[model samples]
Target: MLKVIFLAAFAVGTVLADGELIILNNPGSVHFEGSQATNQSFLKEVFTVVLGYTPKLTQPWDGVEIRDPFLLPEALVSIVIEGVESVKSPRGKHFPLNVDEVEEVTWQAVSRRLEERDTNNTLVRIRVGDGLDALGQSALGELKPNSVDPASLKHLSLNNEEDQKFIEELQLLRAIAQKIPSTVTANSKPDVYWFVVSGLRPVMDLHGKDSEATKEALKLLNDAVNDLSNAFTDIYNGQVVVALFTNDANKLRNTRSVESPRVRREEKAGELETFDAAAQNSSDNLNTIEKPITLRLSKRYSANYPVIFNIFLWFGIVFFFSLLAICIAIAGMDPGRDSIIYRMTSNRMKKDN
Candidate 1:
């Protein structure tokens, strides 16, 4: 038994050391809750397999709330990771979060976006966060070891004051946007377009409620979008991308309540079916893509290393046991050598004769 166990462990280790990469996209539909959930699942799996990390997947609301803002807070993250594809193994793992920051606003915004009547036709929201830094954080922690300044640790923060400053900037931009001359004639032959991005806190309480922190946060986001748009106008031709991120009173209501219960139920059923099909198709496409891609440590950094490690470990064990069985069979079938008991019995038989 001891020999068998050792052999098994060795076999398992070898397989894991040589795993493969898998890619998955974020959810793009209203019914599917975007790709955030898939992203989290991929993260948990990869971290477990590669680095022996065990991160949990929480509900979007709970997960969003606990996330650190300054770290890389996007509503959706795209993950890529290496995982086993054996008959008895977990399907795959991926690392998609571009920024590790919480998606507090994005969650609510997604909810609102999905609930709208014309949601199906809306342009897919594409968001990108700090990319290289985001990947580093996902692989390890936020520590720049090779920095010339030794005190870099003191300034290094996964979540820091920068988020607040950015939020404030967003509000100021919104203010500037409101002031921008709306009279600028729409460009008939626009050469360049302006794009704006902004964000804000959630919406809670409507009556006589007055919370300075919340109000100020919202204003900052509003201004940020507006100002960013204005800047684009100044730089570009007559037209600009009119993009903005905000926590407006109406923005939070991206999802609307269903009026008729029957219709609502039917719509939900249809949406669910569509989302399921889309998810299946997306997964299949990813699998096709991963065939040519080599798996590496960087690829599977977000996975829980131990879990992944154990899978290969099991495979090794199975292989070892198989070898042990072969050895035992050979030992049992050695017809050339007689056993000691058999030899002694044969000598006694000759003496008796």
Candidate 2:
């Protein structure tokens, strides 16, 4: 009964993606024709090429024919390049790029770069599952188990291999679906066709695992796929959707799981100590970190000198006038002869008399 539901869900997802393009990155068989390329250069080259060919989709079932590729005047498309560093330059030289900071590099700019014949000598053989597994693992690893609810902890914990696998699969599906909405809708486009660039390896690995983890993973993956289908359906309501698929889709779907040697060795070595240490470090960082306080001087209250000077000026004028009035009053009024002011006035009066 579960398998039946799974198949039905898969069928629905496949139908929804009938015209969508899936670009898979195969990192296992990268071949450099000329000089060895650095990770930075290789990434830039990949972005340049992939972005250039994204808009022009051709009919695969029929003879090769263009699918009416045209320029989008103000169509805002989001590009999510997974596994690549966000920084355009070396770190420390400038702030590292956050995932949220990735903005659209205009299709025109990409096309112009391609037209200039700015090609790299590296020829990477596109494989079935390139960076998907690593990306999925990273996403799952970043989850803080303690931060989640006790009920949610079981599903998120990596202590059990099966649980880890399930979480990885679910995260991979979510990641792909997330990239589309995050870039397209979050940035600009609301009702226009948006594109997603992702790897298929992690999603493919969902089939190979048969443990309880696999069951849970399948359920989550199905839900995510359904959500993506609904989202894209709404996005494609009145717009033409175009996607570019590279490499063979059959191979991508049927690819076997290749576990990283480092991951396997780490599993053999107890992860408990490492996990505890990491948790401690994170707790320490959080505890010791100070929240920044910003001080702002408002325009309305920032200027004090003018107000203070005005008050002082008014007080001085009043004081001077008060002193002069007292002198005039003393001259008009008479006091006893023993009074200092009276003696001075009498001496002046006696002289005048």
lDDT at position 57, candidate 1: 19
| Candidate 1 lDDT score at position 8 | 51
How do the predictions measure up, each by TM-score? 0.22, 0.26
| Clash pairs for candidate 2 | 26-127
Instruction: Put down candidate 2 lDDT per residue, 1-353, tens digits, no spaces.
Output: 43353345334433332121222111112111222111111122233322223221111111112232221111212223222222121111111111111112222233343333324311111111223433333322322111223366433345654445445444444554444443433211112222322332232344344445434444554464444444443443313122122122232223221110010112222111112242233332222211111232112211355678789999999999999999899778768876776766575655543
Candidate 2 has its poorest 10 consecutive residues by lDDT at: 256-265
| Superposed Cα RMSD, model 1 | 24.4
lDDT of each: 0.28, 0.31
Per-residue lDDT of model 1, residues 180-249, tens digit only: 3441233222121112222222221321125454444334333443354444445333222231111122
> Which of the numbered candidates is closest to the native, going by highest lDDT?
2
How well does candidate 1 score on lDDT at residue 309?
Answer: 76
TM-score result, candidate 2: 0.26
